[model samples]
Target chain A: MMKSRPIAATLAFVAAAGLLLSGCSAPAGAEAGGEKKLTFMFRGGEDEKKAYEKAVEQFEKDNSVDVDIIVTTADQYATKLKAAIAGKEVPDVFYISPGDVQAYVQNGIVKDITQYVENSDTIDLDNIWEYGVDSYRYDGKRVGEGAIYALPKDVGPFSFGYNKTMLEKAGIPLPDKDKPYTFDEFVAAAKKLTADTNGDGTLDQWGTGLNVQWNLQPFVWSNGGDWLNEDRTKVTVDTPEFAESLQWFADLQNVHGVTPSVAEAQTLDTYQRWMKGEIGFFPIAPWDLSTYQKLGFDWDVIPYPAGETGKSATWTGTLGIAVAESSKFPEDAAKLVEYLTANKEAQQSLVDAGIQIPNLKDMAEAWAADTSTKPANKAEFLEIVKDYGRELPAGNTFNAEWYDELFTNIQPVLDGKQSAKDYLKEAQPRMQEFLDSANQQAGN
Target chain B: MTTTMRRSRLHRKEHQAALVFVAIPVIGFLLFTLFPLIFSVYASFTNWNGISAPVFKGLDNYTKMFGDRYFLKSLWNTLYMMIGIPVGLVISLALALAMNRKMRGTTFFRTVYYLPVISSIAAVAILWQWAFNGDFGLINQGLSLIGIGGPNWLQDTATVKPALIIMAVWKGLGYSMLLYLAALQSVPRYLYEAAALDGATAWQQFRHITVPMVRPVTFFLIVTSIIGGSQIFVEINIMTPTGGPEFESATIVWYIWQKAFDNLQMGYASAMSVVLGLLVFTITFIQFRLNRRNQFSID
Candidate 1:
């Protein structure tokens, strides 16, 4: 009996070990709730939460309904939100990305809010940015062209920022607002900005430090290189223009030595360097304004340096506020979305809080015209919005795997270990494979 | 007859109480462990995207695993880290011998050694992440004191795995040292005296007496550590989130987690998980057999 006891305990322990083997996740089950309460989940920082809380407070007061706010950090948001959906305990309204529209629609997770949006008195579809609104539209096969699934919470114009003080110190003239600096002119300015002012045996100042994921877009687009062909069926990153853009991006660090070396940058990343007046150029977005307001150095947005196309380019990032198809109070949820997205007072509060660009065209134009803001080139954000802002290449695809592939093995090129042309030659087939798989999954 | 009937009723009542006690673990074992095992086996053969109902696809996920270089790389990385297990055991055993002597501050040393084992892994990983930083990190600064320019520990593909291994060894030293200490104290001193009288050298006495005496504890630690080490995720997740440079530091569990949660490829992740399960079970089963044989031969 004693021998059997030990053996049986060991057996139980082994069986218990099996628990972790197969259970990928045991998402929390549904919790009890009141009859009329709506769950609103989103990902944001404290300022965004406060802005949203103000808007939602009005929403609850006007509608006489309860809204339970479930805020999460951006990193954990996707996992938690997906777990909720998979468990069939989805929130009434949640923030979604445009990239997931196909799967969400296929799974009946998102409701078709076309009627709600069209009939919403506060939400004038015509007044909102067409780029923002159309991102949620999907026909059965194509994205960006059919019934709307969600409303835009905000349209984030990814803007280029330059240190005004650094330019003044270097005796460099400010860039033109009407016309972007050519690539050569930008590089020359960057070279002048790069110096060892502290004499620490290491260069303390850098021209620019750009991450490939976010900052590479303007360079690629202005150079007439794109990740996908129009009609969105082919992987087109293997073009010479793309290689040239990529090599130039790398050359800023490897050839020109304008940006910080990898080892130096590891200690303090480019963003931190820019914050400390060590980096001359960085990317800024609407979300950064609240933090950037407290900077020790003066800075402002500029047109991205131009390439062969002779025009500035950047991508607009938008978060979609969606009502789940299974939501108990779809009308109230839709109203909240409309209010947060389009109501003048709500939009004004959000814009003043520096959480977003205005969704309404007239309000945005007015906001851009006011030169009192630190950016001083708010019109550049408007220009991108009205003319040059494009959706990221992944936004058009069924899944982002193909687009994400561009950066997965890009270190070799960026580190100057491999030529950009050689890297792209190898990268295209892999990207094509993912794109083809995505197509098949979408039943294309 | 009346007395016997009353006794029988009391016996039945006790039997029912014991049954209730036994049922909890059995039910948990079935629901949480066995059922998931069966369901995942079924899931491994499907194309479930975690959002929709699974569609059956025979042998595709398995065949793909063979060609998946990331899967192979992660598997290799996981096994490569097990090199630290034996190295850690050797060091801890030596520490255990030193600690077994009647020395001052043994308890203080014990506490210090075990501190990392008790510390929350997330917090330790964060501390280690900064400590592994190239320029300003604690590790590099120490190396610079000795006139060696330390490479970037976490960022460089060549050094990332070794950095992780060092951290693992340091964190695990305390627990193993404690176990070995307990095993050493239980060993009869007279055997060592007899070996000494027989003119056995200190090293020979250690090899013949001390090593064999601690064999069972060693077997236990090895079995448990191998199992525990294979499921290493939190440190990898917190430290090298994007799997480090060139995916060099990516372990099996971290990759499985990324595939399952981030990519929503639950079906493929399940297949990978089942393979890991089989690998762990096979290794454990072999160890058990070997250990039983050793015990029998000793007898």
Candidate 2:
């Protein structure tokens, strides 16, 4: 009887525990105003997260809609985003990068915002760059077939930044701040800056350290060669222009010995290396300026040198705000997007964080001359961007593979184990094959 | 008759209670592991990218794996670690043999050796990164003192894999040694005495008795170590961000991680994971079979 009593008590305890776990009340806003709660997840560090939260707070104040902001790490954000989409628990408003826009559009996960953009009085469509909007567009429209999935909220454009101290030490003439160096002169100056300053048999200082992964695409684009054709259907990377650019690129490491091997560069943390003045010439994006400035180096931004293509093209990045396809209040979500992104306060907050360049033209000019920066070259930085800017080659296929694939395929050439001609020839077919398969799957 | 029948019913209830306790855990096991495994198998067949509806990709992922150069490279790298880690296990076993003897400060030495096993792998990986740095690392400084120029440890392709192997061994040896020591103590001493009675030397007795007695532990260690070593990622991730100066150090798990997480190719990554799971299953199954078939029953 005693044993039986304990067993009975145990069963009762288990039942109570289970009920305790299951019977917990849901949060107050879980089901607000009989409308389903929508979540919006984004990747940002502490300050960006706060800025976004502030925007969300303003959004809630303006509209009678509930928005749940889920913050994730930049490293894990894409995976979680994809998983959310796959699981059909997509947030009402979320962020997308240019690299994965096509996949989202094709998969019908993102709600097209074209009509909303045109109809919504709150959103000034002209405030957004046409090219930036068009980059998200597919099938000759700024949105999915007739739908707009996302709009650009912010932008990041690449610029050639140099260490003035290193140039002075190497007896190279300081770059003309007003008139930036041309392409040939940039290469010549890099060579002059390369030196064995310590009198050691090995070189002590390198003139430049090209990031083999994220930083290489601009150089490829700066040349006439590109990863894809105009239609984004085929890979045509092995053109004569591409070969010349790659050879010149390879020479920075091999012939001139001005930069480290592609392998060494892969392992090198470029910004940190650049901060210590170990690297002289760095072609970096605007977001990197915060780090560069934070490092307190004597640095200046200059326009990227032109190739035979006769125009400079720098890789640009945009933060995209997308609406989910399955949102109950697509209209409300669109309104929230409009409110959060177009709000002047929101724009200013993003600028203040230095997370990205403001999408609104009017707001950007103010960030241009914010003299609070210690370097005091804030005006020049904006001018450099104004003169030479192009968006990163956007497509469905531009992915994490964007860096790894290019690095792996092209690294052999730098090692002299394979010729540039052979490497590009092999890479073109392989890249095209990936593009074809991915696009075909996406197109369906 | 009513009382007897009631008591019989109560006994049956008690038996049922025992069954319920066991069945609950089994049910949980079925739900968590068995169900997910079955779902993963189904997922492996289809092109499910997580967001969109899955399409039938029967045998396509499996077919694509064969032609995947990176996948093959990863497989090779994983196998390299499998081979290297066991060499470490053997050294650890040798160390355990020495420690198992009643030596001075043996308890203290055991705690010191086990320190790394308890420490966070993130901390270990970070510490090793500095130690193995090519130009300004402490390891090169020590090597220079001995008049031997240390080759670029983490930077060079040839040395990167070896360096990781060394780190893996160092990190794992303590745990493996403890396992061996425990097994060694349980081994009967009479067997050793009998061998010695037959004019056997210390080496012969160790070879004949100790080796056979510890065969089970060796098998256990080898199986678990192979699984552990194949999934090596943190060291490579921390020390060599791009899987070393080249793709030389990229392993299967890291490659899968890059594909799924970095690229947002969840479908492909899941498919790769399925393949990896199968490969591990096959190897473990084969080792289990071999161990069963060739049991050295010294007892």
Give the number of the best model, judged by DockQ. 2
Give the worst 10-residue stretch by lDDT in candidate 1 chain A. A22-31
Candidate 1, residues B1-299, lDDT tens digits: the string is 99999788767666655665577679778987999899889999988777788889999899999998889999999999999999999999999999999989999999999999999998999899989988567998999999998987887878999999999999999999999999999988899999999999999999989999999999999999999999999899888877877788899999888877766677898899999999999999999999998882232
lDDT of 2 by residue, B104-211 (tens): 999998888899999999789989887887666688899999998887687676788888888888888899899989999999888888888899999898887888
DockQ values for all predictions? Answer: 0.25, 0.44
Label model 1 with its docking quality class.
Answer: acceptable
Per-residue lDDT of candidate 2, residues A1-444 (tens digit): 765775686677667755664443233234645854556778888878988899888877777667888899776687677766655577788888766666677677888788998898877868765545655666532232334567776666766778888887777887765665565787788778776777887666677877655565656667777766766677677888777777777776777777743345543445556777777888756676566666645777766666766565666667788888877778888887776677788877877776676777667676666666634555544543454555555444535353355566465677566777778877776676766665665555
| CA displacement after TM-score superposition, residue A360 of candidate 1 (Å) | 3.8
Pick the TM-score winner: 1
TM-scores for every candidate against the unseen true structure: 0.89, 0.87
Worst 10 residues of 2 chain A by lDDT: A139-148
